[model samples]
Target: MSIRSGLFKLLGLCLLAGVLVAGIMFPVVGAAGVISNQASETVESMSSSLADEPPPLVTTLTDREGKPFATLYEQYRIPTTSDQISEAMKWAIISVEDRRFYDHHGVDWKGTLRAAISNSSGGDMQGASTLTQQYVKNYLINVTYRGDELGQQKAQEASLARKLKEARIAIQLETKMTKEEILTGYLNVVEFSRQIYGVGAAAQAYFGTTAAELNVPQSALLAAMVNNPAVLDPWNNPEKAKERRNFVLDKMVENRKLAKEDAEKFKEEPLGVLPGGPDKPASTCVSADPAFGFFCQYVEDHLVEDLGMDKDDLYTGGYVIRTTMDRKATLEAKKAAEEEVRKDEPNVANTLSVIKPGKDSHEVVALVANKDYGTDSAAGQTVYGLPYEVFNVTGAGSSFKIFTAAAAMEQKKYGIFDTVPVPNFHVSPVFNWGGEHCPTRPSGVRTYCVSNASDGADTSMSLQDALAKSPNTTFVILEEETGMGPVVEMASKLGLRKTMASRPADGRQPDPDHEKPEYSMSQKEFYGPNELAPNGRGMFTLGASPVSGLELANVAATIMSGGVWCSPTPVLEVNDRAGKPFPVKEPECEQVVPEELANTLAVGLSKDTQPGGTAASAAAAAGWDRPMIGKTGTTQFQGSAAFVGATPQLAAAAMVFRPDIPYGGLSYGGPGNVHATANGNMFGGMTPAQTWFRAMKPIMADLPPEPLPQPDPAYTKMR
Candidate 1:
């Protein structure tokens, strides 16, 4: 047959097919009427014989403070129409998937026949899909394993019955709306991955450009993907993608949609990427570090519930996440950190944690030295762990002293100058792994001036001297006298996380069994018996129970914020599609301790940086301009590190780790197997301190220097 004659015949068949569908619509009226009527009756009967079912619940995505982000899909009866799509999108899709899309009722008989015939010699059957078929497959059928609601895109499956249902729906849709409208709807609802649905998402994903800005070449490429993503996924199978592109170009040429030469040129075009990032909405990828990962996960968990979403819906659906993250501080610190971490090199894994303070916000900022910064860190690569996982477990060290001191003051354990048995605590019950006692034995007046690891000598010093020097003996005695019950209560009140401490700790008594301490500590004036917490025992003082930098920093931020509980937040606000604010509850915290307590804590932080102190190195590291007050902590094998402090403008925390990396991970890979450094030793000070400096310097540079919030001048005498 002549080309023109064949075209005419094809057009004629499509029009006739349209009429056939229309005639088949009314079960009581015409062709196949009786069978259609019976089917309707049966469907009604099935509907009437249903079991109990409620409406699909509405959930939401929210920010840290429980403000809404977006809703899961709301339309129950999935509907499709061309008006919901872009015009160019419709035309391009039609040109590639079904050249006779305008005239056909739903299915293209000639294309189906051609595909069937081609399949006889096939590796795979070429799909002869119409816009209608695609719509059915996308929303109503398990063309690729569709289940009751939405199923994860898993193993491959096909649906002949769904295709039939699609044809019927298309006939009904055609009567209800114009060909243009149906195509439009199809474009709007098409899944483009990246959590982006339809033409809108495609425009953003493909070109980093908008739907309105899509040129013919860009439009055509996207259109091709609609038919078979494997053939067009730009990331994988680029050769097949090239083939698909060329095929579309050929179709456009045949349909007079493009000139033959132009089509060739377009086909040769090296696909230029969309200028911006992917259309997928970004979310915080939490790491195995149990501290704040679970906290952030808690935020997401609540957001999903608030947004009324199912797990699948939240994971796959596009959402605008709002957070209280002070990204500037978090990232700057991350960058400054570990610039030398890799310098430590050779599989020496490391991690970092940071937190910010707010009126009702608290969250981790940086995990490692940029380890989990963007889509990269232990978090991004998912190497550290899944959401709500724990990464590092470190001994909190002297930072824990802040709480003990608070307890000392509150419980009247000892006054600042009040003398306790100022002896080096090296031989105290708390021994290191090799049965070596801490070197921090102190004796007479001069003994109190000694360090926590004093080579196990005897010395005596003032409580003030002990506080500044981190004399393990000071805290041990204070803990021994002051008691664990008050410390647990005070720590929780200050925002410390409940942790499973492995040891009864240095000076904490009434802890026979080596159980973890309890966040649930009460009743017992001591930190608690091991019975209440299987993992809370042993080292109660000296930070045997682990706490994250996030929590510690939050406590510090609260103190810095002048006793007003400034919760750390990872998000700022959550706005809707039109940028409307959602209602959220305000978070409130109590001032469990007096403001004077925070003042004293800040005092200790400041004095520690003076001449003789645990963190003299860290204090000297900073220029004193953004003058910081931070405490350092280190774990044995894993070598965990954390520092929480603030400038006048911002308050944050920095945490780093090598996972449970053998404290040996802190050493070089060569012949010199440096065992490990002091508990107060290692790079936590250098890296964590640097991380804090980097984060604070930039922020400080951006603003005018404000005077430090000085504590009460007269209250300087803790005694």
Candidate 2:
């Protein structure tokens, strides 16, 4: 060939290389006077603007003691700095993927020229991407183009434009970051397997080790997966995986990262991975440890509903959530609940909630249920939010009588020690009942009438005595005289806000024509003539509406805190992705009722564990001898029952109900929802009171015995 023809051919090859480099290599081609001015301008016009945000990282959830219990994430990645990574991992990856990683700025120019010439001759596409270029591509795909499928595809496409863009941005990145920084970022953002990213997660998932502890063989096996993770997966294709791993070991030997003898010895060793990979943490709240699952779920709900945080941020924003969940308290509560009512019991649920009382704010420590928190129904696991949610739960029964009592004292019309008539049966002159649940009179008008739980308690007694015995007729008449509106409002101010504001979810929209059409059930009951009861029945004191255990526990907290009301906060602190304090909307605490009235009421409630109280039997069975306030309640039709009580330190509530059949009543000594009981019937003083005593005995073992607040003479005086 002629010398001129040889130089022309070489020049043609160099110009073809400009296509991949966006004409950044035009200076070398321009020496032969073969580059166009338009191409030179195109190279100068290409921009490099890479995002500087860190990749998605795993969010951790810690308990009351700041110990990690769960992890939430969109991608299972734990970002590690260069110093935290082992030297074997760094050298092995460099040896197999990019041999001249430290020598090159961002792109391997010599390799690019050779690949361009080979491709121009119709050869297959060859890879010339340096570590920095690979880092740029991964950063765009995982962080910048996140959730944008088209943008992610465009970033990874094997086109000349994509390569040119990556090369330009990588060169700019090299200017800003050191070679070690580039390598660290690349290892942190690269996808080692489906849904698994970064060397930290990869080491744990594959070999049950950390990034800093990876040895030579494990490092070689991981480095081999960078080229094709799907094909070289050690779990599915072990032979191919071993072959690729040995190839990486050979490269490590050639690059002097490992001695030849050590490389060969590594080839003889087994894969040495855990049998089925490491045991990953519960990725979601439903899969958390049964002892802490419900509390974890409550934290999630509080973040989203109460604090106005985005639901997606829990998994993607890398927050460090520190919650007020006491592990010992929660486990004790769960054990007590399950011990009282077995988890596998048919159609029954037992839930317990614990709250720490404070004058300013209340802190929730435990929320537990007899059923395990999971998706498996056959194994007695449930994913329903039974502890926190009020939906589909049966009525709170006479546990609501505390609200009526509080309302009477707040009005200064009745004192706790005042005399009230308790009849065997009394008919209401104010309200006429509806068809099914009550009796119809001969005049075609059904007057509301109720009887006491025991015929012996028909005589007149103090309001404090009525509360301890929980007679139906006395509280029913009390509701009539105190006015249902004030009673219902008092429940809202105390803690039953969500329960009182709930409406049936039967596709019922608000009435467009009525004033304040979006009123809740409690509002309708107070205003009179609601959907269920015409002229607004007097069932408010009897706990006619569904209620939340969490709210009931907070009610006890309110009384124990001397009438102060506070939002039941689960989170103590939350740090954002950048480790800064994330501000949440704080609801101010207020004294909902007078401190004197609350303290007087607390004294009135303190007699429940004494001689003639409803919960006396349960308390005695547990060897109880504490100064505490207690109340037990059973729904009129045996649908549900509850026990709420408080000490100077902690307050709690426990309930027994039919979760599957929300409105179904419990049957005893026959074929019914709840089967095989200690007694022929189930009541608030039965399972619920027992559960509370069993749970609180151990929990209060270490707490010092403290007396409740003193009653004020103004409210304690009989009317």
Candidate 3:
């Protein structure tokens, strides 16, 4: 062995050792870089996908007084800005969850190293996720699992890949948002328990206070629950929850966020969790106050149908709607109807609608019924709201005679002093009749025999006397003199028929013995007639047309307002999330008839409240201290009874009938059935008038009395 041989051998060994080290180190470094790049890309993609999306928030509904009545939400979260969140909450969460939350960019290397060592050593896996990372994970979970169950499960799966993705995304989020913004977003999205997302909702569910009002101990408890809500739910696991709360307090103390003594004091205090077990927001009419149920439903319907608002958006758009409902009037009207109708005939259905006729907007003060409005099977009752009022046209009975009287007066051909024939049974000479029972009639004329409530009425009387007595025969003759065209037009001007046509001047007379002659008159004939006649087959004065309670009330209101007709409205205003006002339809008003005719008609209707009048007893029973006027309507066979009345300030209408039966079937009751006792049948002047009187008394209390205007001298001169 020589010196040269020894040196070459040592050099060869060193070179071989260098090659071995390079072989192991190169692949390990390259693989680490590749994994890091993949994680970054995944995070960037996730963060970018969610950057433009807003957090899910709750929409609230408030009453006219700005009090919250209902809420629509998917997660019950009310998002709050950082300014609205308490400092104690932010510090407590940061101290316990991530001590170096503000110090770290997005990931804490020192914490990660410690977590890795702890996890690899077979201990419970230590969480090294910073608040930013947690926020990223929460965002992913929310966006992915909002409406998808499977996606939610995948978002929360315990996997290395998921954790790596969260970490990468969190780092990216830090650059795009400030620490305070990130903290605010994190607090808003973190789940504190089942179906409880965000600090705002958690505060309400757990403590009944707002997120901005949480005390130190309260915040610490909430902060502790974020780790494992089920295990630390104070209501379900008080001991575990207390322990975790104390642990969070201790961590706060370690971070100098709270004093050690303060931490000890908090630990000694009981859990003190005030949990709202379940929410009972007024989401539907059934859940609303019984008195306001129908009114609320009316407002809701107007929003969806009349205003063209999306139903989904209305429930969840976070709108703040201010309605036109007068709470006092509503409550009073409801009480009046319930006390009057519910006691006598439980089976009888009655509806009362009151409106304030305004110059530009007519507010529906109240819409009430004897039965509650709802969808519960046990709550069996029809929903009598706007739909019922505007569509379900009930027979107006004698109350409709005002139109005939108005037509004759407006034509200046007849006045309150004019005399008309009133017979116990009189048929219009215009209706053509066939069969041997019918006497010979004029050409193109019919005999439609109509009877009055009283059998002693074969007399001619002044117009005012006939009106006050509500004699069916007098109005029939008045219709004959006035012509059906002007009569129908008078009713139409006062918002009677949605569609109207001229009555035929002549028609074939039907047989007097013909059954269902009224039914033979089709809807087109009644609504879209094409000729002129003395009367609508003599039934027009008997109130054959179907009109809703609302329409009837408006008619009375029109007279009360001296002929101005204002469309009914339920909502006053609507506001958006940013407190900006949304456009709302104003009340529409138009003069339907001349003030002179309206005043004269009003004076004629007022006589019904005097002695020898049909509704005189009801008017006295109403106990009104001020002058009031109304008409009583009783359909044939007593199928329905209605009273529409008004003071100068308020107007209301009520109807009593069996909702389940057709309009012309069995009476509500007669002589010992329900409505009537003795040998008498129910009349519009009975229950309906009583209900109107009772409801109007309370409603009129707050309104100053204004005497109804006198009829103009031109119409009065005929007297």
Could you estimate the TM-score for every candidate? 0.68, 0.88, 0.71
**Better model by TM-score: candidate 1 vs candidate 3:** 3
Worst 10 residues of 2 by lDDT: 503-512
**Error at 255, model 3, angstroms:** 8.0
Q: Which candidate comes out best when scored by TM-score?
A: 2
For residues 407-512, write the lDDT of model 2, one tens digit per residue.
8788776799898788887788666655355677777787887777669725888889989988888877877777767877888898986776664221122244
How many collisions between residues are there in candidate 3?
A: 20
Better of 1 and 3 by lDDT: 3
Candidate lDDT (C-alpha), each: 0.51, 0.79, 0.69
In model 3, what is the error at residue 347, expressed in angstroms?
Answer: 3.9
Model 1 lDDT per residue over 123-206, tens place? 233376677556544643222233454443311133333333445555555555566655665666565544445666567666
Q: List, residue by residue over 1-719, the lDDT tens digit for candidate 3.
A: 88998797667555544443332232324877676566556566777765545566555544556655445555557778899999999999999988999999887866654554454445443387898888877876764466677877767665544555566677778778899988988898888775778898888778788999999999999999989978887888889989999999999999998999999998999877775452324555656677777777777777777678877666545667777677777777777666655523544666788877655666677788766666542454555552234433346588878778888888886777667678876666755434235565646344666667877634877777787788887787777777776777777666553322221111122233545433344332553233443234456666655566776787787887778887677777788766798887654688887888788777767777788877788777766667777788887767667788877777788876655445334444342123432122247777777777777877777778888779786665463
- Which is the better candidate, 2 or 3, if ranked by TM-score? 2
Backbone clashes, each candidate: 97, 0, 20
Model 2 segments beyond 4 Å from truth?
A: 1-16, 23-51, 110-126, 435-445, 504-535, 576-580, 662-681
Scored against the true structure, residue 583 in model 2 reaches a CA lDDT of 83
Q: Residue 501: error of model 1 in Å? A: 9.6
